[model samples]
Target: MHSLPESKKNHLWRKLVWHTDTDLHPLGPFHLAEVYCCDESNGYAIWYVRRLAKDDARGVAGVENADYLLQYFSKNHRDAAIERAVMLANADPSADKVIAALDRLAGGAQKVSADR
Candidate 1:
């Protein structure tokens, strides 16, 4: 539940920037999710941001909004974590499902570490 530093949040906001007018832009406005990952001391932190608007005028100011979901996984699970993030980002925006899936992944990571 700890928040990311302001510098890291700014970097993530930059990565999430997208223009609806661009052809490369993905479909859907509010349901669209942007995935960002950063290496942390304990593990890799994956952040999912579900856009609430097409324009998303809130910009960097909304980086720490409650709508953001942050999940951490051991470095050994980095690939899996990234894959899950991409899958969730492309899938429908179901908060419950996303949380459950992340919890499962985090559980697996913890179990692996415990086994070690």
Candidate 2:
């Protein structure tokens, strides 16, 4: 449940606005993910630990690069970028397991009661 510090979030938001001309919220919390500037481009990359399931015991981590100025400049770019970031965050080596888990969740997996 870790979150970026306010200063860091502001920095990221500034960069996004400067590059994309879109004033959008910064990335939300993902316990095993981090966002940073890419050394090779004027863009940001996300490094994340990929898990096959929400409660998976182990994870495979890697970095995914996306160009904000180039790949995310459209009107709907914010939503698209967020979706891509989420997909990258959830990426796993066991693709089938990930797909199955996603399918189950999309098809209405059981929900836990908040009071539990």
Candidate 3:
């Protein structure tokens, strides 16, 4: 998580570390996920994707206005939790349908805000 801007670096790293240690590698060897999550607050997520041949060359990566976006999460912790859930869901191939449903909900929120 070193590559993210200074503000995001620590929090992302903590999440990655916590998720890796607590969820993925409860009792076994340190998996690639742990390694990637540990150092991937930056582009390391992309790096892992490439290494694992999961890189979608056509898809966009990276965060937008990282500081501003993270500030919103910091102020609303539950929103941050939702964001993480989206990330996890997006990672699962079987969950694409669920992810799409969540996206529709998110899109509706955008529409409501835009109408304000």
Preferred candidate (lDDT higher): 1 or 2: 1
Q: Which residue pairs in candidate 3 collide?
A: 1-39, 1-40, 1-41
Candidate 3 lDDT tens digits, 1-116: 44766744533322221122437557754321211222222322211111111231222232111111111233335444455534643554433343333333333232111111
List candidate 3 segments past 4 Å from native.
10-95, 111-116
lDDT of 2 by residue, 1-116 (tens): 99976545522222111121123525532222222222123334322222122443432222122111212323334444455545632555454444333333323323222111
**Quick one: best lDDT, which candidate?**
1
**What lDDT does model 2 reach?**
0.32
Tell me the whole-model lDDT of each prediction, alpha carbons only. Answer: 0.47, 0.32, 0.29
Error in Å for residue 9 of model 3: 2.9
Q: How should the candidates be ordered by TM-score, best one leading?
A: 1, 2, 3
Cα lDDT of model 3 overall? 0.29
What is candidate 3's CA lDDT for residue 55? 38
Q: Give the poorly placed runs of model 2, Cα more than 4 Å off.
A: 1-4, 10-75, 93-116
Q: lDDT (0-100) at residue 55 of candidate 1?
A: 41
Between candidates 2 and 3, name the one with more favorable TM-score. Answer: 2
